[model samples]
Target: MKRALPLLIFMAISGAVFSQENPIGIFEDNKDIGNPKLAGSASYDETSQTYTIKGAGYNIWGQRDEHRYLYSKVKGDFVATANFEFEGNKEIHRKIGWMARASENDNSVMVGGFLHGDGLMAGQWRERKGADMQNPEDDVWAQKRYQQIIQLERRGNTFIVRAAHPGEPLQEISSKQLEFMPEAVLLGVVIGSHDENVIETARVWNARIDQPVAEDYNPGKDGWIGCRMETMNVFDGKRRVIHEKDGRFEAPNWMPDGKELLFNEDGSLYTIPINGGKTEKLNTGSADDLNNDHCISFDGKMLGISHNDGEGSNVFYLPLDGGEPKSVTQQAPSYLHGWAPNNKEVVYVAQRGENKVYDIYRKPIKGGKEVKLTDNKKWDHADGCEYSPDGKYIYYNGSKNGGTMQIWRMKPDGTEKEQITFDQYNNWFPHISPDGKWIAFISFSPDIELNSHPSYKKVMLRLMPTSGGAPKVIAHLYGGQGTINVNSWSPDSKHIAFVSNSKKSVKVD
Candidate 1:
């Protein structure tokens, strides 16, 4: 944080009116608000609307071990204004004013003025949580300061901090864009005291918030877009293009040796080297007409796919080396989603009734009667199902509770069910990590009002700790439909393989 002051025109306004009769809501220090155990004291005068503090051992939050102040019940966006004149012992680390949490003792998106022992005032605008402190290029909010009245304002996700000399116009210190949690935040102001050049008095006035007028708006435009690919490296964040062309290419699954990627482009199955090069067509013959969902077996000896053969879509398996396809399901309206970890079974979403509602079902890979896994009647459309690495759980995303799609997990027998993700965004396509410590998924905002479907535009790929916590966005780009984990973990778990479309559209071959 840096310290620089905004210039102020010396209007002949009386201090009484500025402190007491001000329009914005104000709170003055009354009684001894400073540390009681210490020798310091703080009091407020309602007539002057000024809060003053004097003595040693005085702090904002009453903590004696460190110089921290805590103010609670701070709701909405507001400002804190204070004036301090101090004669402190020589120490460059002394701070004048700052807003922070009472418990953790950390600075937030607020105004902070620091007075170095060398007599220089520095100011800064900080976003500790959102900052990429390790990479300076990615740390857009990090800044430094010198003498200044600092005004910090937060408008929605954007935070602006400015400073100016006692009489000059405020100079912009720094402006940082941030996504703050929608909860009440704590705020405070404090001065760190060192050695004893001590007799000093401070006056704080004009501290209040100016909340913006409410308006109906879409906040999703500011969200990150996820890169959609069938075989994406989750750890390294690399997208491999197996069968990209002038048209749509999708659902890539890795070969057993991880040397090549198999996918569907223009309704035909094709194979391409994992390292990127020309693709070789896998002869689908009369079964060439395929949908966007496909998979490879654990042994890499077979390919299972869903395709429309003149009549309707059906699940089929073919030899990886290329051969006649074997129909695995006669069930009507079945679309392949994923294969079991053992390669002995496959999960598909089957449509039921005239409403076209879908429910998850599984059947033997070698052909057997389908077993219903989820019997919900609320249009339970399930997609991207995969077995946990340990084989204890099956993770998938489904549309339930109206249009809100969320990631869910169930036991192998579809017994114990649980819903993940409570945020307002539409989360889908969950893929658990091989280590089982994390789950990567795609999220699209359903709050956007548009005539078109919600999944068509920008989306985000996020990762969450398997134990449960807020998901962090890892990649932002355009994509949807066929994103999934199609292969085992790279020996290191540092990369994932998934399919994605090229930025430029290509004609279908």
Candidate 2:
């Protein structure tokens, strides 16, 4: 179906006022290219922080092509991401997504992380001007007609394409080395009809362009980085960075009231307004050296903290309002992760006695002998264990293949253990939702070592049903250790709080 472009209405939105001189001020520049009967338009919705674009042009294919493009000029390496979908099923080949081009000419060399109207999502590229189109091998193809989370990045000469359904991690769909391409080029969202006479409309929401470090770059050592407290809607996969700081902060614990977040920095725990604000320290008396492992009990009366007490790590309980901490687990190297529903017991991962092997243990808050739930061999280790909301099972991560770490669940008594997740990456921290209907966990890259959960890597926060199913990536971020060490799901289970790190001065309220 064809539509008139001029009839499309474009609205400017943001905390900053946008005028004719500041068209889509978020980007360096943009244009609706290709001669068409109707001009394309872009609109921003302040409430949702989303962009809507309507355009008309011929197919962006063949020896040469035409299409309405919304672009920004950029130089050097960059990462661009957006959640996109067409306005309607106007045409089967209608295309919309992130694009990187060497030039605006129809025959320009380019690569696209695209979602097509026919539900054919692909990473398509043109090697050079007027060249034949080529796509990645079969291993990377994925499809869906609805909204897609697309990411396109350029690292040196390598062009990497990633995309996925919202609430899922972006999978690497295509990668190509374009050595001849210029250091600077045009990049942004694009729309095309696949037929010159036809006009198609679409949207690219929460679009972000990140200037990241080299793949070999090690953050902090190479350069100091800041952190952002981020929350995502579990159902829609919409993300918002609620707070940011000049230095690193880790392990967000959403308060029971949902009005604030508890995070740790410089060995001290602090609370910040959920909407973003100044940080105030929470006194723990003499228990300092707090790590990222911390959680609020189901009753919301006490906080379980993993504190380094000079001897080593141990679990401690303190009043939610901040007071003298009471030691719960006297065993050193014990990292507290979850609190039982009754709030009388705490689950932790520790290397007790001379074992030197980490395993899940259930320790009574009132003091009792620790119960070891895993007695696997020396090569085996377990971590990220927490009681199910219903208090029937304890979910944790273990190497089911004796190499690849998979999510596992067992009775609280350590019986009937079974693997719940089977995939490429090392999945950890299975934090069940308050309602017990969903499970959220952190997933490391497949290239990472089997047992290590390191920081400063590209990782995915994924979601799945509590009963078990294929997991979906909810957030792609540069974080690991401090990202999600505890159950951070909101009380209502509609949202989740986590942390992301970056060297850039990106700010979002």
List candidate 2 segments past 4 Å from native. 1-26, 34-38, 59-78, 103-108, 129-147, 165-173, 194-199, 206-216, 400-402, 476-478, 503-509
Candidate 2's TM-score: 0.83
lDDT of 1 by residue, 382-497 (tens): 66676776777778776664567788888878889888788767776676655678887777767743211232233566778778988775544334444432433433445555
Judge candidate 1 at residue 315 and give its lDDT.
85
> Best candidate, lDDT-wise?
2
RMSD of 1: 19.5
User: How high is each candidate's TM-score?
Assistant: 0.52, 0.83
Q: Which candidate is the best by TM-score?
A: 2
Overall lDDT per candidate, in order of appearance: 0.51, 0.76
**Model 1 ranges with Cα > 4 A deviation:** 1-233, 236-244, 448-456, 483-492, 499-509
Model 2, span 295-362: residue lDDT tens: 89999999988889988888899999899899987768888889999999999988877777788899
